[model samples]
Target: MDWMPAEKAIEDVRVIAAPEPRASADLEAQLARALSLRWEEVVLSIGRTQMLSTSRTGLSLAQRDRLVRDVSVAILTQIDIFLERKSDRFTFQTLLEELADEERTSVASKVGAAIADVEMEKSGFRFRANARELTFEQFEATQSKNIPDFVYDSGRGDETTPSDVVAVEAKGSLSRLRATKSRLKNLAKKAYEAQVQAFVGSTANDSIAVTGGCAIAFGATPGNGDCTLRLYVSAPAGGTDSGGAGAAVRGPGLGGARIPRSLSSAANAMQQLDKKHEIERESATLDPQANGNGPGHHRPGRKRRRGPNAHGRIAFANYETVFRLCGAANAALMLRQCLDGAVEREDNPVMQAFYQSSSDDRFLFGGTPFAKCWSPSGYFAIYKPAAEAILEALAANRSTPPDSVTLPELPKDLSWEHGAFAAQADGLTWMSMVRGDFTTKIWNLSSGKW
Candidate 1:
């Protein structure tokens, strides 16, 4: 595909920061339009050339899916960059400053840094601050107590009691800007609860006081896209269990309360294109001629028996398809490890028996390192040995040998390039052993059994 054109389109779309007294509505509009147009072009190209038509580029179905995923990631990365611009009020730093200014509190400056420290430590579940870890018990105790917007030690050796603790609550949205208000409310409740717990654990003096507030950053705008910073002096009394009963505090300046029309429109347009592509794929799958299914001519009662050869072909085809998509180096390494683990494990009687009986080192690998056996042709060679091992084990103890092991049915149109059999990848490592819902035949030897 002509990827350079699309890349250029994305590069050309620039969002200039809005000056004071102006909103970013125009910039958002331009970005939304440019991105949406490029997205439509790319999606339409994939749908028409790859999904709807037969593959002429020699790329497998799995490779096509990976390509689509890569394109989607690129689009999302651009959106992330746009939202992360320094001048945007939706940026994390901007929101913190707005919250501090609204509360007219000196402690707000430290709230952002404290939150950063807690996050970096991965202690959100049990936050560590002030050189100590606060448990859920402490958090619950101060649920009803008033907390400050920012709190810290005075560093004066004379006074040791914890006083005027600041609690900060902040939330931001990139995709779900519309949910900013509700998310902020939820964060506010959580912040209050945490602050209250800290205060209760720190001092017996209830008069020491706690102050705090909530800041919501959202949308592609200067003043955080309709979201405002709010501050609270004390925890609300007898509130709706959420500690939100305090008087509503509003910050200075107008906040963007709604997502810009252009942005939402662009998002909706891309979604529609994706939905359209899905419908087309479904339609193609259902068409018998397109999927390689011949006219029905089978006797109704006759049971079709699939032998080890069929099973092997299906496994080989599915694995090879995925291996090509994931790249030869990574796929070869992972597949070998999966097969090796299955063979070594004592829990899986089928794999254990197969490995013991089979002398073919080409497919079974035996004790040989995968790096030595790695080849484009070697990938195709391993399927039969893997399939035979499982089939042989299934037939060993059963009175009536499983006449045919069911495997995952591939799409009707998919050609095997060899003997006919259907299969799907069960994981990155193994393919389905049989078609149909019979759980016993499925081989996940890497995990020991089906």
Candidate 2:
């Protein structure tokens, strides 16, 4: 494993500053479109319940059903399709005990990842794309190198000017044995190095912007104690590399910002995650083709352009690292309709507009870091697939949805009622659910916060 002394960890890993107003507004608009697209897709899900989604799934519904059927017959067990839906929601003994050890382990992993995602959003980073969705070939081409979990929108470029993005790698660990802050420090530093190697692609940005990755880990379901978090901002690929790990340390409020002994809860998370851009050297070097089409090619960053000391080259480093800890997408998902009929479930028109506006079509959905329902105030998809188009529709078009981008019926009852799930950077903080019914049926994912 990579090695970084305790003193260096304190000096190097740090939080980023908040995004500029323009970038924030840009992301907000993109987020609105993304959430709007989800509304449309969910409506379609209602329509195609019988159909099997053959797209991005671990198992087809039919396959799963067949597997269940085989297993049930072999064991003389009845397959109750509605067992989950019909089961007692108020079953006190089965709050989470129903899961097997392995299942719990898997869930614990996701929960840790989800909490990390929540922390990043709470800190102000925007998810752009998920690397896992892409194929190996596609991965190397469209996504950033080193395969950081998700790329942030970068909020820097436009149709004319290609912008850069910050590629982040998520670090999630189940603290099985007695782990210490010293150990996690090296992991964070290692993540920083991964971020350094990442080259932003997708024809959006030429060079990367800001440090990625934040160093934070979560306790496993059976683990003990709070985890440490060092939100490090590393020297980006295009940015100037700090001479070494011993460079000067800086952050949004470096002198004032107190490094947390551990990110024990949401209360400790920074209000607005903003960071200064100290990378040196300017200009996005274009590829030989220079057509601005396809995954445009470009060379790696040149020699270290004297940037700030903190944003320098170090042994272990980069993120959408505790940026921490964690984070994480798709399309007309095709479907096999009933009655042996092949239905072309038309893709969302609103999404079509958004996709049409996008230069890269690899992304199917917006990057949402947290689980189904973990955002403190709740979270929404924020990647801007159709940013410019949506802006135009809202501004000039006379129609309610601008003719091309009609929105779905607003969502309802998506939030938890008292005992859903509350999380922090460390892990799933708590779970509660007195009743399963949602009486309010309110649509919380509106325009602004989304």
Candidate 3:
């Protein structure tokens, strides 16, 4: 190992981030239909990316089907909320404060992500690639424990060079008002994770040499039982947190791809996490006692099978895992059922073609056996390549590439302006028409090889 001078042991990564995007005011039916289609498109695309005929990609056909079912249902549930409540975001935000820890974390995740995209664009950055898909070796350099949610280029450069870029992460909480403000203060620590990702991306792109900034947005309470959102950009260079003067974070620290970061940066980040955890525990409901139970503690029903997580390393269910547990026939049937449940018309060719994909589960799913684990390799395959591929295909068909068209790309995509698919009962309304549906029939994956 090469020795580094003592004075320069730590590398510092920092960024400027902020934003808020307004939700679109589309009618309930239009929103339901758009979100439903998006939910389907995203799920199918992810499964396709994860497997794509395993002989070609080597993923379990059954696992792909299972993932499509599990992940699609989870995404649909969130989209359904908008349909039922219309645009009353506050209702959802306050109710969020009352959810169980698992559910709250889930909701906060989606909300934080939406906020991060807006914050980055509002500060002038165009989407590049998702940092979550980058390998951990990249993150190791920054010495951060978390991953940045997304990466973006400023798009201000000429054809000869790429724009300045930044890694951005979203931090959020729906805890009670007091806790919300406290949580936001410490959210700064999470930004360095983004900085690390941006740093790595820059290394891959030949050190185009652009500055980076962190984006943090969290629920804030200025009134009783009321929740307003906020975005924060850390005070420049002086990363002097409330209690510590770890070091002054400055400059891009460009061209030092091999440099080691100071231990203080990692320490401060963890310290901030511990402090935030303590704040969340301010109420009795947040954490029950017993540190003595220790790190590997397990409580009854404590572990949950969250469908898929970008950060998960623990092996959960993947398509191949599910296919092996449930024989090909049953697995295929499960896929058929879920796909049928989501169908609105008998003539919707795209929906029809997916379920009628293939007879052989190996071929039916896709063949990337090694990539079948529901980890960063498969579950996390949801972003980057798949979205880019679809958008690229879409761009080729249109005169103006989507990357150039500056509209509210998000909720707008889920609105009437985006057009709709024909269905007797639009969206999940059709999903409900079939009572005792196949979606509720959980194919237990626990009875198989772990």
lDDT of 3 at 363: 13
| Candidate 2, poorest ten consecutive residues by summed lDDT | 307-316
Residue 116, model 2: Cα distance from true site in angstroms: 2.6
Ranking by lDDT: 3, 2, 1
1-450: candidate 1 lDDT, tens digit per residue: 112223222111111121212111111111121211232222222221222112223455556545533533333333333322332222322343343333412222222222222221121111111211112333444432343222221111111232122233323232233225455445444544454333422421222222222222222222343322222223223311222323332222112111222555655755775586456445432111100112211123323232111121122223322333223322322333332223233354333221211322212212221122212111112233333333332323122211112222223343223222222222122111112221112333333232
Give the per-residue Cα lDDT of candidate 2 at 292.
Answer: 21
Q: What overall lDDT, based on C-alpha atoms, would model 3 receive against the true structure?
A: 0.30
For candidate 1, the clash count comes to: 27
TM-score of each: 0.22, 0.37, 0.38
Q: Rank the candidates by TM-score, best first.
A: 3, 2, 1
Off by over 4 Å in 1: 1-80, 84-151, 154-163, 167-170, 177-183, 190-228, 231-245, 253-450
Whichever of 2 and 3 has more lDDT, that candidate is: 3
Residue-wise C-alpha lDDT for candidate 3, range 1-450, written one tens digit per residue: 011110111111232222111111111101000011122232322232222122122345556556544543453354334221332222242444455777766655554454444434333343333443233444455543455554455443332333444455566555564335445545655454344324432332223332453555545331233333333332323222323433232223311111144656644654775576355334213112111112211123333111111111000112222232223343333322222233223232121111111211111111232233322121111111122222222222122111111111121122211122111100100110111212112222112110
Per-residue lDDT over 1-450 for candidate 2, one digit per residue giving the tens place of the 0 to 100 score:
011110111122234322221121221111110001121121111111111111123565445334422332221111111112222210011233354656544433343344344444344343233433323442355434465554443233333433333444555443444124455555555765564233323322222233333333333212222333433343323232234433223332322232332334312332222122212113323222212221211113312122111110100011111111112101111101211123334343322111111322211122232233322212212122122212222222211111112111111223233433333211112222222321211111111111
Candidate 3 residues lying further than 4 Å off, grouped into runs, are 1-69, 72-98, 121-124, 132-144, 177-179, 193-202, 205-210, 220-227, 232-450
For every model shown, the clashing-pair count is 27, 31, 22
